[model samples]
Target chain A: MDWQKLISFITVLVTLFLIVRSEIKKYKLRKTRPCGSDCNCAVLKEVSLKKLK
Target chain B: MNYFAIIGNPNCGKTTIFNELTGLRQKVGNYPGVTVEKKEGKILFKDGTEITLLDLPGTYSLTANSPDEKIVSDILLRKRIDIQRPEGIVCVVDASNLERNLYLVSQIIDQRFPLIIVLNMVDVAEDTGLIIDVGKLSKLLGVSVIKTVGIKRKGIDELKRAIQGKFQVSTAVRQWKLPEIVREEHEELTQLLIKHNSVKEDVAVYDAAALLSSPKQLKEFKDELKPEILDHVLLDHQRLESLGYDRHSIFVKSRIEWVRSICSEVVSIGEKKKSYTDIIDSIATHKFWGYIIFLTLMILMFQSIFTWATIPMNFISKGFDWIGYQLGALIPHGDLHDLIILGAVRGVGAVVTFLPQILLLFLFLGVLEDTGYMARAAFIMDRLMNKVGLHGKAFIPMLSSFACAIPGIMATRTIENPRDRLVTMMVAPLMSCSARLPVYSLLIAAFIPNLLVFGFWNLQGIVMISLYMLGLVMALLMAFIFKKTILKGKTPDFIMELPPYRLPSLKNILIQMWERSVLFLKKAGTIILGVSIILWFLATYPKIENGNPSEKLAHSFIGQAGQFIEPLMKPLGFDWKIDISILSSLLQREVFVSSISTIYNIQNADDKTVSLKSQMQKDLDTSTGLPRFTILTAICIMVYYVLAMQCMSTLTVVKRETNSWKWPFFQFAYMTGLAYLVTFIVYRVGLSFI
Candidate 1:
């Protein structure tokens, strides 16, 4: 492949990797703390988890 | 590092003081419930000592009525296993409303934490012709008192010095004496808790009193206490109530009486004069004029979003076009060049042009919030909210949803009733968050004309506000349905404090605008860019070497998927490309604009100068040989976006807030079903008129 094509291929690969990683992180965060990324009400999270269980 | 927590009643400027001390802009609005969760920042002292400062949500008392308020008592009582109790507490109170503000301080004194009282907003107090004897008040409270104007950074150094000094637990005696029988019951319960639950002696008293006052707290200790002990506590609660002593209000009443007595001793009235806040409030909160003024402000804000943002948007649009041209020339004619210009530049540029609109919206919201007008807006909205069977407190969360639904969902923690909170969460996403701004702006700017209405209002601006009002009306309608059918309950009384108005801090407003703008840019660079690249790939291959661009795209992977979905969307006047955009935007609403841009950029690869709006304007359906996006189509799409549950993040937050997958799934089904039904009706009705 040409140099430019090689760079484009690598860029696309990296973008895919980053998107997947972000999705996984968001999923795990949702499991533990459902208040989204903006809040840190861990007490509520615990109570919620206990209630869920 | 030593830890300190700043706690106070809502709107008393705990966040303002926290921001001033830590130099972090943690969103200090003049309305209550601005900080719905705990935010922590480190303050570096002069001697290289760093103290971790936590800004907790505001609460009225330690009795802990709502989930947000419960977080305060949980931390202070050391009930949560995750967070350690702070070494000292900074009890921030509004100097202008000391008598009411000190009720929480009295509760804190009973906890016996090393404390400092920040008499914030002293200027507001003085403007009302009240002088406070800080020294005498300090002696009476038996804690160090520091007077401060948090917004101006006045007395910050003194406050910091006091925080860094050796801390002492307040030696102030509990001034409010419990009645003889209530004291007996409280002491008895305290000993029982210490003996049975292994609770610490210091906190056991507070816990027992809380449990006796609010039997709901017994659920927290259910695992620790035996059934007999729980039954004993329940019996004491019943005995107090039977004796005609309101178990709930006795402590609150006594504390208020003590705070009033202290205020009488330490506060002196200088002159009886009407403040500016009063004069403005006469009309600002007047039942008739308030609605008129609010509607006028809404019109002006929506008008400015269009009028003020045009120049900057055009510049940004042209800048991206220039960059795309330059890059297209620099790279050889190949797939790499196509990817760079089509995938990255055009796609991201399509969304970035809306930055000016987003910034203007945040700026207006910041000014309204900073000047305390937002609270009045809530007050004005209360009667209507109650009529729809929602708590007046739900108004703040709904207003917050205009920025984004995530924080809006989180802000529902301040609603004490679960059913009311759930109903609010279900409808908050229908408020047309900033993510949908691109879709609305794109469609309206392309199809809606900018004629003068009644010799003043722009037709485009009116359409824009109408779209917003449509979302709001649908949200209220849904809330009403939910209240009357599934989530039926009596609307509780709405009691909100109307804060005195002050001049908005320009620096704070600018910081808010800057922060929101950066967040938008980040999303453009990350999610939008990623989706654009992927869409470009899907449309590019498998390649047809001898085919025209349209012929090539028609058989591409994205084309196949779009064509598959096109049949389902045909009734709504959407073609395959619009179907693809709709499906992609489920990840996030703004992705719809970028998806359309990417798709169009590939279709018109030969034409480099046409903007997305113009391309959309020229697009035609092959079967009918007519323009694909008529004004009716634009209106239908805009209506669909206003009601659609298209954001994954909002769904995830709903799942978390409601603590069930059932609610989020139900929300998705209902909102999407509503969107489809409404858009179908509008489209069919418009067709009949034509």
Candidate 2:
């Protein structure tokens, strides 16, 4: 394939991968952990300590 | 290797000290089975002995009321397998508030670990006319105490040396005498724990006290400890409560007394210093002036985002245009050239041109936070939040949502009420994030007049503010409705400390700005790049055998699809092209801008460098024989975007945050339905007038 076609194919594949990877990971995590309604890990603040000093 | 922990009360500059000691050498991971982050760093001594420093979550005490506090308690109690128990503890304290801050120190010292107390923010204490005798305090607590201003990096060398030196276990365990009954109960628990092998024989007295004091602590060790051991602890707890000796209060009272005794011995006050921070707080948290100031600041921030980013956006747009023009000339006029020019470059450029505005928004946020004003903003918004049925703390996450909903939704962790947190997460995306800026800017620039509202105010900036406020108004309205009906719960009180005001460090603000902007640019390069190519292919395929290149777009798959949906978009003044762009926007909101650019580039292959704005302005409606982008149409589109759930990534994040398909789907349905209704109203209303 030409560079244009080659680049377009790779780009499409990468975008699909980026979108799919997170969904699958989140799916597995939710299924396995099932931390009730209150345990949304995404909202957890990633701080070196509590509150930004 | 020696393991050490840095523990402190909130806002005592513990994080600053950790950053100084670690300096970009720390790893952030989640504590096992909990979402709270676990931070660990390596500190190398001159003698080549390495110390692993764990920055425990800052809590007032080790009582474990919150998940973060539980993580700290577990590590200190040697109950976590993910982290090793520290051999020594660096108990950071705020010297300015020694009486209150030392409460946690009393608890830490009870652990009987080799401890060093770094009295942080000594400069603030000295400014407040409080003189603390470091040697005397150290002697009283029976631990080494070093005074340091964490921000100024003063006394750091001494602190490092003290950490490496021969460590001494604190005598506070012996000094602060517990009640005879409680002491007897603590010993019985320790013996029981050791007998059950739930705890080592060398367990600290405080850890034993924690077992009897906190019911949560027993639950944490439920699998390890025998049922009878837990029953016995609960039995002791009941016995203490029945005898009018509340274990929790008794422990708290003893710690407070210990802290007060140490303060009286080592600290002297020359005068009660009056604070400028107090004066500022009075105004910033005032009932009336605070709201006015907040609104004015928000208006100014939005105005600057629109005005300041224009020049850089223009430069980026032009640079991309010039490159596309060059590529068009160098490459042969074929499918390959068209794909490169229309598919990738224009798509990325459409999103990236808005980076300057994104960076400026984050810069202002960093400043507000660093100056200790963000907490006050939350305080001011608390009463208003209560009116809308959300806890006052919901304002912080909603404010964060103005930047991005992912982190904003993530910030809901601070909210204690599950229903309040869910409501906040569901409505967070209604806050107009930086991603929506490009669409609003483009539509406003194309259709809205650039004239001033008065003699001085820019009309365009006012429109930008209106668009943002539209989102805010809708968010509050939806939060109110949801809280009252679906996710009903009592509003929790917002309790937070207001840190002393200090000059914001320019380095930290710039670093924050860079990180946020880089994340936006990365999306442009990766996700937008891919989507654009897919869109280009759809818009260029199934070409007619003998058609003009410009007309070939109408014959392509995308054009047919757009036409198929054209009737649905007709009432909102959107044509086939706009319909296609809207469809593409489902992946990402900013993709709408790029999709339009790609479509126009494909149609206007003859005119290479004409800007997308002029093309949008010149686009004509076939039936009305008038320009397609009218003031009414632009307003309708902006209104639509303000309410639409266009970005798929946000939905995924919502799913992850809510941990169910139910909430994300409801969010998507309600938002899309609201967008259509509002857009129809705005469009119909505008058409009636003009």
Candidate 1 to truth, TM: 0.96
lDDT per residue for candidate 2 within A14-48, as digits (tens), equals: 66787567546654554333221122122232111
Error of 1 at B334 (Å): 1.2
Query: Model 1, which residues run further than 4 Å from truth?
Result: A1-10, A29-43, A46-53, B218-224, B227-244
Winning candidate number (TM-score): 1
lDDT of 1 by residue, B323-420 (tens): 99999889998778988899999999999999999999999988998999999988988888888999999989999898888878888888888888
Give the CAPRI rating of model 2. incorrect
Tell me each candidate's TM-score.
0.96, 0.87
